[model samples]
Target: MTPQQEPPPFLGTWARVYWGVVLYLAAVIGVLMLFTASFRL
Candidate 1:
């Protein structure tokens, strides 16, 4: 099999990776909302 079958180095598990992505997306959305509110957009 290819290296894709192995787990990530830092996070280790795919579940953690998924959660990390979710958190990142949430953070980005939160920042955009704050920016929009500040600009009254």
Candidate 2:
């Protein structure tokens, strides 16, 4: 027998939510790097 799992509230499923978090972090880091470079120039 298999256990039934519930989907997350936003983003459809848990996996999508995880990927969304990853992408958000990457975007934040990219923006931070851009700011750092602009300030250093």
Candidate 3:
């Protein structure tokens, strides 16, 4: 048997790694902002 390598399941390419990282950061930032606003009250 031989080994095989595959890219991201959804993105289908290595570029998805960078995209995923950026999207994750954006999501985290958005969540933090919401928390900050809620606490400011």
User: How high is the CA lDDT of each candidate model?
Assistant: 0.91, 0.89, 0.81
22 Cα displacement, candidate 1 (Å): 0.2
TM-score of each: 0.75, 0.77, 0.61
Give lDDT for model 1: 0.91
lDDT of 3 at 6: 56
Q: Residue 6 of model 2: what lDDT? A: 72
Off by over 4 Å in 1: 1-4
Better of 1 and 2 by lDDT: 1
lDDT of 1 at 8: 81
The per-residue C-alpha lDDT of model 1 at residue 35 equals 88
Candidate 3 whole-model C-alpha lDDT, 0 to 1: 0.81
- Top-down TM-score ranking: 2, 1, 3
Candidate 1, residues 1-41, lDDT tens digits: the string is 57988888769898999999999999999999998899874
In candidate 3, position 38 carries an lDDT of 90
- How far residue 31's Cα lies from its native spot in candidate 3, in Å, is 0.3
Candidate 2 deviant stretches above 4 angstroms: 1-4
TM-score of 2: 0.77
The lDDT-based order of candidates, best leading, equals: 1, 2, 3
lDDT of 2 by residue, 11-31 (tens): 898899999999999999999
Question: What residue runs in model 3 are displaced by over 4 Å at the alpha carbon?
Answer: 1-12
